[model samples]
Target chain A: MSLASRELPSVAATMAPPRSPADTPAGAISGPSWLNNLRAMLAKELLLEWRNLSRLGSVALFGAVTLVLFSFVAPPQAGARRMATAGFLVLALLLSSTLSLSESFRKETHHRALTGLLLVPVAPSAIFIAKAFANFFQLVLLAPVLIPVALVLFSVDLTATSGVSYPLLQLLAVWALASAGLAAPGTLYAAMTSDLRGRDVVLPLLFFPLVVPVLLAAVKATALVLSGDAMGQLGSWNLLLLIFAVVHGTLGTVLFGYAVEES
Target chain B: MRGKFQWEHAVLLLALVLLTVGTYIGLAVAPPERHMGDVQRIMYVHVPTAWIAMLSLTVAFVAAIGSLWSGKHKWDAAVVGSTETGVVLTGLLLSQGMIWARATWGVWWDWDVRLTTSLVMFILFAGVLALRASVDSAERRASWSAVAIIVAYADVPLVYFCVRWWRSLHQVQSTPETVDAAMMLPLRINAFGMLFLATWFIVRRARLELAQRQVEETTLPERRSVEEVQHA
Candidate 1:
């Protein structure tokens, strides 16, 4: 009874703010408008993320730690070291993405909170967009912390820009695109596997392979950003990253209803 | 969908006979290539398997779309069948490519375009199988697997393009002009043979999935009715 009551207020409160259910008679209103529902859900997602800022901190630390390990694995030679730096940094982002993606849905299992989200009758597309957008922004946030950590560890200075225009901005663009890539599919797969027993293993098994193009494109684009873009080929690689994100994001919106409705 | 004597048997027999003849002719009758010599014979089996692997996944992709739209058992079964067949052939294709690579490149593997794409494709589809294995609810299993298959299939073209951009050490694609006139017969024969063999495997797999589903329904009569109503 207590859990049911708690789940109802936040959902119902969004519908009618001034009047409680007791004051507003049965025929007083229909359910919340679709726009209201989406806004409420998005607000709820961001609010939850805001509440767990500490978790974000830990996840950043995790990404930083992975960066340190990647630096160790790179060869001692200077030329190869620069090449490996971009790949490893994006790889760290990809790996850290799995952590928070899984956690985002795992929280919904508490008192079956996701079931409440569904029972709130939120549109599945709205649900997916909210979840995917939150996850995407989370990945983007990691970039600020991780990029500096990578620069310090790899000892690459931005001021040494040769044939490169706006190195920092280019890196940010690639990071945003890569995060979009991971966020779409990762949120979808995490939604499916989060209800399973071996989710930790299952999520990565599905996610990592699906994002190979993202990893390759992002790594390549990042490499060009770090080094000089002699051939002027960075735009195409960044476009590839954008393509993956857009394709999966659209697909996920269409399919998440099916993946989530039953569970 | 079930009968005493199925079309799969005919396909199986035809595939067997064609494969035997094609292998014999490829081994003894076809003239050896001037460059790779006898080692090039592997292309007969290798190219056919690669073609059929793509076909299998395409079949899976179409079936995935079908399953999602119709929510039918047969579509789900085809998703399982063709995806499993695709994975098996991709594994075989990888090994065959490795043998060919060792003979030519003098290394077990290289980060060439097709080679890396094929390796990633193999892991990608195989991951679909692994995803399927972990889902316990039959309904969720069907939909989720279809979803995964579609999502995975979308990446194939993307992987091809990205890998091409990254690097291309693999040789140029063989066209009719490039391939020797004498080599065409075995290649055609093996390609058809492999196609039939893949069809037979898909039908057999779909039948097995249906049979298992039948056993489940019989065991859980109450749930079967519930599922029927759910579908209805």
Candidate 2:
């Protein structure tokens, strides 16, 4: 079924004459079908991103340029350069993620699409989850391009150095977990600021301070992995990253309904 | 209302008196530390400011919960007042810390757990105030800020833990056991003085906010009616 037809009953109940017996059953039935509504919303988000591929391309380009600038500013010593690679890479991802988040929510506000989404009968948390997943997916796609460019530009030796191994698997794991940490809060803040003036300026002000733990843990984990101490030194930082992800993800999901309500 | 003002005035006066006595004790009565000498006097202000900063933010956090639970504007005012006070204290703490660090650690800044967490807390609550300012509607601002404060406060422990586990170049937390008894007088006095001053600030600011909100509530409908008459 088309998305509009599926949402019509809920929208109709909200707009139509009050509490007729005929509409009451439809409203009650629709409230319990939030799972299907969530799936449809998630699909719509992905489809939207796929159709507008340029957004993804621009984010990738932004990350690439940031990486280049960082490399130039970095120390020239091979040892020092290797040590700084992970930090620079995470910084690039963070700056690019901020831009993407601002753009995503600005579009929603410009088109008044967020209000329409809120009008759907689905739980508001579903909208948050879907948007977070869309952001996480975009970051995942950018990681391949950004990581390789960073590794080459910084002259990082990813091969096992001394007693530790710097495997590709560990690097990807850290990237994914860190991206999840960033995306959950990023999407929530994007929603919170989208309706306000100077939202672009406000997002970073509110976002960076809150995400310090994430950046700290991610940079630490990436550093450990790159230095070939992945298993030994990474355990606690990994746990911290997991906690950061879970706390933010759960908070964003629960509070998002309240955040976006009556906006 | 007159009685309330009297109590507030009394508290402010007591804080001022204690502050004067505390500075005297901190400068003259307390003996200098053997290691750092007189430069350690900065601790009299620094420690109290740090304590009050954290205490004020904790107050704001509780007020946030109350605002969300009761949906009362008074709680919102409390949050705003305490949060603004906390931000000011945090700024003072950072400045005091920089001076102390310069004397003790020989550096203006260090990435130690306490120092980093203080910086993070300052930025987070300042952001809260900024978020409060950006929104137009009072009700919307209150609810959104309540949620934001809760989220930011929740991250405090995590920031502390991350910084602690990563590495610490600064000394471990100071407790009564570590501090000499002779040094404790000024520290205790200043702590109480800072507490009273912070409470006075919060109470006065909260009253101002509530009065402003009341004015808006009273005038908004009249303004709307005037607009309606114009349209008619």
Candidate 3:
């Protein structure tokens, strides 16, 4: 992530003295480099996210609720239920992600704490990375709660699925990939919309269509894990998810400065 | 200078003439497809509209980068104009596709890969516009909307591939060589005509956007009463 410092120039970069150490992160000056700052910021983010277990509880509950509601929408026919279980599980995660992401930036806004952090000379890239990782971890944590509930509610037995040698492991990997993909771009949009009016509507509006690739790939991969991957197509779908995560992760890191510089 | 004959008028006239001629030839001159019959004629307008919409989005992506890189109002205006044009053209393209689908496929909608991606593309750009609408400050609006457009533009390829991989019922893309000789003229003419029309719309829309910014920046406070001013 420190590699981003060379190419990054924000409102702060223009206003700060050129002789300052922030611009040149090669550690020539004794000041903290981008990586150190990123570490500190990431630690701060994890600490905050860790302190909010109750919040995660509510979000998990929301996911479970969404899972239940989705089950009701499908007919009781065994074949159709089995076919749709993967979609239901992923959609629950997708919906619950909005709940968690929208709140991730709220803590930063109180008392203009975000402005205070920016004043402390934290690189926006660091802040973005920290927030994205924290969000990613939070969503991953949801897998423990939501996946089991989904399996039970949908009457799915991963062990009985075909093609894949390790269905449970594959499903976990799919969840993590989807979470990472959602977290990167989700963090960026969440930051933009956090303080805006009608943010609830705006965040999902901007996010859902943009992350269609993630949703599609995750659902397909999960379905394959749950049902069968006779054509050995699971690897390709997982690759799509990884690509989505990487592209947006890099983009969000580079663009965060512009989005949050004014604040 | 206020009422001068401008280049936009010339572009607009050319677009209209080309569109009229192209539509006529597309409807009357081009031979119907062997299977779909005259229903294939919808492709004449639909294909051009799709091409122009995609082009407009590419322009929007470029302008988005320029806006973020330079922090210039002109770039922001271009972003607005191009994205708006893209959205409108995509809407028209979808409608035309639906009409063609209804005639041939016996349904108005299906989960075809290209169709899904196009719909998602439409929504993504529309979301950018929605974000722009909600922001009150012009600078923040410009920056945020540019960010949104960049993100959305980057997602386009992924969206297309993901949808395609998930389920693909749509036909493969058609090239000029695959098309009949008689269909080529109308397609080429209409493609150029749509491109020109999109340019005309983008230019005019950008001008209006820049004007709006000027109005916002130049609005002065109400004139104070003479007595109150003298006392101060």
Candidate 4:
């Protein structure tokens, strides 16, 4: 047997027992019960974030600062200014999401928690799915504050036939969909780079290019919502976003097992 | 070893001959276009470079799948070789495209579908190479890069479709029907020349990767023992 496989039992012995009975097989958890492991992992991630609100706060602060700075730098012209604001909003979210993803993976590396997780009998894909969901949640949490600030600063006309509530709901949908699209590849790339030094530099270089489609669709959709597209052009962009989310999410889950096993 | 050297030399000689003839045909034999005159000649190089760029990446994608399926060092070498070649060709394609655009479109750059998709492809593969460089272990690097290439390749069609649907200022994509028969000759010649050159480069680079891996294996035998002991 390979050294890694030989060492697995000892590592498993050192790790805590599975929290749920379903996760623990009669003897040694032979094959992971994916759904149960996913639930347990996702809970652990959420609980960890709840315990440490500072990290989420910092990410939100960074996004807010970016939006404010963008609003100032953008030309005060009416038409161009609104379009630029949509672009910048996507940019800010992209940057903040990159930071949060790297940080989330960094936490595991910092506390050596990854080793413990790796030791668990659950499939590595479970860890990936859980981390992706957690990152998506964190990005969603930023929407309430970030969206309002963006709308106000960019002078987005929300008083359409349906009023502010409709646009707000549209924007939130964009955020959630974009967040899923971003987080899948973001979490996977974070795990890939977690062991490397200078991962801060490496992650964005790897990430931004891969996620360009997501950024483009999100920005376009957001612009349409801001301008109030009456012709239903937004549907195509939303479809693109959905395709991006599904493609990356599925790819990340399937590939994460291979990526995380590297160390 | 002797056979390999003979094939390499033969391929090199053939590539040189084809390239010289292709350049002559492209620059001299082919009549200038009605719209742009001699500046349109750049298409001979630009189109082939773009074609080969996509071709090389397609090769890399296949090699990535091969590496994942067979877990062979040779497949990883093929991945590296084709990917690196794709990057160089992509860079060439971009510059030639800019030159062609400046003469024809009156702008050095346009956010057109093809240009945007090609740029994204270049960045994506370049990131794969960068990722390959950062990792320490051969096995890890190979496997991770294989996975990366597959993921990046998945985006190729998506990027193409997205950009195409979003905006297109560039000409409608050229096909045999659009290209003049006389103009098609040089384009075909240059394309074959490029294909031969790309093949030689990929073969040579793959061999180099294999040789380097061999040397690394011999020189770093102790690292394995150390890892084994650590795991133990």
- Between prediction 1 and prediction 2, the one with superior TM-score is 1
Measured on C-alpha atoms, candidate 4 has an lDDT of 0.81
Candidate 1 docking classification? medium
TM-score of chain A of 4: 0.86
Model 2: lDDT of residue B112: 69
lDDT for residue B104 in candidate 4, whole number 0-100: 70
lDDT of 1 by residue, B1-232 (tens): 5457897899999999999999888999998887778998998999899999999999999999999998999999999999999999999999998998888879899777788889999999998898889987788889999999999999889998998988844566432246876798998899999999999999999989988988886788787678668644
Candidate 1 colliding pairs: none
The TM-scores that each candidate's chain B achieves against the reference are 0.91, 0.90, 0.90, 0.91
In model 1, which runs have C-alpha deviations exceeding 4 angstroms? A1-33, B1-3, B168-177, B221-232
Lowest-scoring 10 consecutive residues by lDDT in candidate 4 chain A?
Answer: A1-10
TM per candidate comes to 0.91, 0.89, 0.90, 0.90
| Per-prediction DockQ | 0.68, 0.70, 0.70, 0.65
lDDT of 4 at B157: 83
| Model 2 bad stretches (over 4 Å) | A1-32, A161-166, B1-6, B168-177, B221-232
lDDT of 3: 0.85
